[model samples]
Target chain A: MHEGSITSQIVENVLREAEKRKAKRVLEVHLEIGKLMFLNPEQVHFWYQMLTKNTILEGSQLLIEEKPGTVKCPKCGYEGDFQYVDDPALHMPMPTLNCPKCDGTVKIVSGKDCFIKTVKMLI
Target chain B: MKINDVVKAEEGEIFDIELDENILKANAELAQQNRELLRKQGVKAIDVMGSIGAGKTSLIEKMVQKLKTHYRIAVFKGDLTTTIDAEIIGKHGVNVVAINTGKECHLDANLVQKALRRLDLEATDLLFIENVGNLICPAEFPLGSEKRIVVISVTEGPYMVVKHPFIFMDADVAVINKIDLAEAMGVDIAKLQNDVKKINPKTKTVTTNCRTGKGVDQVIAALNL
Candidate 1:
């Protein structure tokens, strides 16, 4: 529901970029949504269209590219996408999801972010 | 940035700052604004972070009661969904506000700035921010808090210190909750202490059983409140 909270911010930045470049007639707005941010691209799109009206980005297209949630495993020399599933080898009582290599806990390398990475417009 | 005796443990990898440059600037500006407001108001900020169900809320509740009588307190509690933490803590009557993070793993400075609009930092002597309950995300950002406190329970792992050293490294003090279960789970307190020292020798860590109000007094004393 705070989609507006973030969307409004994106629109402002999109306008700032367009203005900095001294461009007119905005075109496509580029966004990079990180997996760790827990934001849905579809929800962003839904709000983007609704929020951009009557502004510099009015009728401008919003293009979003998702960055995966990657983590580095301490035990295994593997760094890639993370999957959370319960597993047993991790510890005592219950099975908890862990690193695929050495059953170690992995830390997210990136992907939890919501930002207007790049914005394209006509001069 | 100056190096502080922390090891990378490996070579650097190529990644990128995926967020918008403008948004990053905006966020930085917001953090500065909150920093000014906090200073102007004399509000002391404490950030609470831990894994899901690690007892962050219980410790906060106890702290609110402990500090409220001597001074006015404001709380900013973060959760992915539902204001249940805020609602529960509100019953204690300490002017607690909830931040529903929607899907974000951590709370950045900009969000804290927005929340500050709703909070009167001047009327309050102390402020506590309960970060989202996951250990992985909250370590990424600082919410302009004067003190950052990381809450960990005994059930998580003895290796928790090694698992999330960043969270603890920034913490002024550490609160280890669920102490009553330490014995039942065969927890090694000494090992946990060693792991914590390895991560951060400066962090003052304390174990607490929030359900029974044990060790909370020590928590207050550590903060000098």
Candidate 2:
């Protein structure tokens, strides 16, 4: 899963930051995941636990915050949250890129980021 | 352990560290490196992404058959386990590198960088990176290619476009492969093209029947190669 790769990166980043601060161990990690990203928070947390074993972040708490998808229409200056088409039968939700105001193509404004917001460490 | 009389022993203190950094920064940086290296070698690399039975391998074969005489071509076939697609491309007398990603759902920049090391970039003019047979994951990972092509066959049904607009948004060219089967399958080719346009207006759409090599030339032209 891609979450494994992403978790490895997160671990690396946290360890590096902890080392820079001369910390004894990591206490917590904060992550911000955009809605547009295909990452599942549960999968991320699972992989993070598995990857942090025997490392400075072993007992650290992983906190994740999800960012909503937002888009803006250039033609009509329409800016708001993206509408997703959800059907229980299809078992898939697709985001609509068309603008509701002018029915024009809307540009993605947010919800594509996957980044670490902060970290808590024991000094 | 208690040597200091003037100072008192204290437990370690916990502090908060702020690091607002993107997790994909490393991958994106590597992708930039690959892009520069390819550009320096004057190699035009195209990333091909599609479903398993969307005829991605066949379309690459058709392209190699048509352009092999005029240009030196190479291919990087990405799969979970088997080398079947790589073998098929190699049989066409072109250089092919099979990258077995094992359990990876999509090929990332690091994998492509490793594959590039094994290829003679100086001797090759065109490089085709056939991504793992999936639409969702590949859309998130860009392989430092000059053009990204997404192939969707008529057999994938009408909802393929609307269902997966993210891939089309990242694609530079969209190839509707196996168009010859549209009439037999009772699919609307025009409606498919319209759906693609609705999702991504800039993406150039081409209809092709790779079996007969029809529309392959147009695809090449669309890539401006």
Candidate 3:
């Protein structure tokens, strides 16, 4: 799983940044995950908690910003944004990944990255 | 206080990503270590990327047969369902493990690393990653592969090259399949070759008919087999 690999990198980065700021304890950690990344957030959180057991980031709550998938319509060439969610009442599918404008195959452009945007630590 | 959905007057510039510093640093470090591991083992990986039914599997089978005679090869098959391809290659007497991605669109580096564990790296020479049959997601994830080969078929139309040039852009080699029926099917090799060249000036495109094993020698020569 990429989560294991991504988790390790997150730990490494946190430690590096912690050393830079000369902080002994980390307060909270925040991460923004894109919907179109094809990355599993639960797996990421699971691995992050497991990997950060005794590290500086241990016990820190992970703030996950859930971002939706955005697609570009090649027909109308309109890159409109939409959330890929399920409508239980409407009986719609989860991955309704189509262009709303011209009803063409949607090409994904943005929303695929794993990074640490902010960190709070006790100085 | 009550609030309603906020509306903006202007469209926002693309964020490029939902940037997460933790995940980015973690992924980068893991990838860095992965690169080192590949280097230490001298594990040269090649990814075969193409659209569905572009004869990707046929070319892979041919190459594996040729390479198996000389090199200790292994395969990391990424398919949405069924390990049939992996099973077939394993019969050829090389280590082949399939990564069945139930719904995911692509195979990332993290997934590749897990598959590599089952393969004996010391005994392996050519590690081939038969990526999920698609032009998009496969191009995004770099599974620490040394090379990427984009396989295109003439039946699909030469225009596919122009539409998805990034596949060629991320590739070190390009293979066009189903060339035996080129004339019969009214598919022009010249136009296809030109379309490929327009996207990548350096991508080596070779026409092949996997059914007859025609024009596959160039691939062998290119890989120094």
Could you tell me every candidate's TM-score relative to the true structure?
0.61, 0.84, 0.61
Better of 1 and 3 by DockQ: 3
What ranges in model 2 sit over 4 Å off? A19-25, A49-60, A69-93, A96-110, B1-10
lDDT of 1 by residue, A25-55 (tens): 5767778777545356788888888888787
lDDT of 3 by residue, B1-225 (tens): 777887864332211122245454433455566667877998878888899989888888888877788788888889999988888878888889899888877777777778878878999878889989898767657777777888888888756766665566556678888987777778889877876665444567888888788878897676555
Stretches off by above 4 angstroms in model 3 are A1-123, B1-29
The candidate that wins on DockQ is 2
| Greater-TM-score candidate between 1 and 3 | 1
Better of 2 and 3 by TM-score: 2
lDDT of 3 by residue, A1-123 (tens): 357766677777777877777776666667777764546788888987898899777897777777765667667887767423343642543333345675465565656565577777755
| Candidate 1 C-alpha lDDT tens digits along B1-225 | 987797654333322223355344555567677777898899888888888898989998988887788978888888888988898899889897788888887788878888989987768878888888877656656567777788888898676766565466456788888878988878887777665654455567788999988999998888878
Q: After superposition, how far is residue B62 of candidate 2 from its true place, in Å?
A: 0.6
Query: Candidate 1: what lDDT?
Result: 0.73
Please give, for residues B84-172, the per-residue lDDT of candidate 2 as tens digits. 88999999999999999998888999999999999999899999999999989988877798999999999988778887878987777
Best by TM-score: 2
- For all candidates in order, the CA lDDT equals 0.73, 0.89, 0.73
Q: Candidate 2: what is its chain A TM-score?
A: 0.93
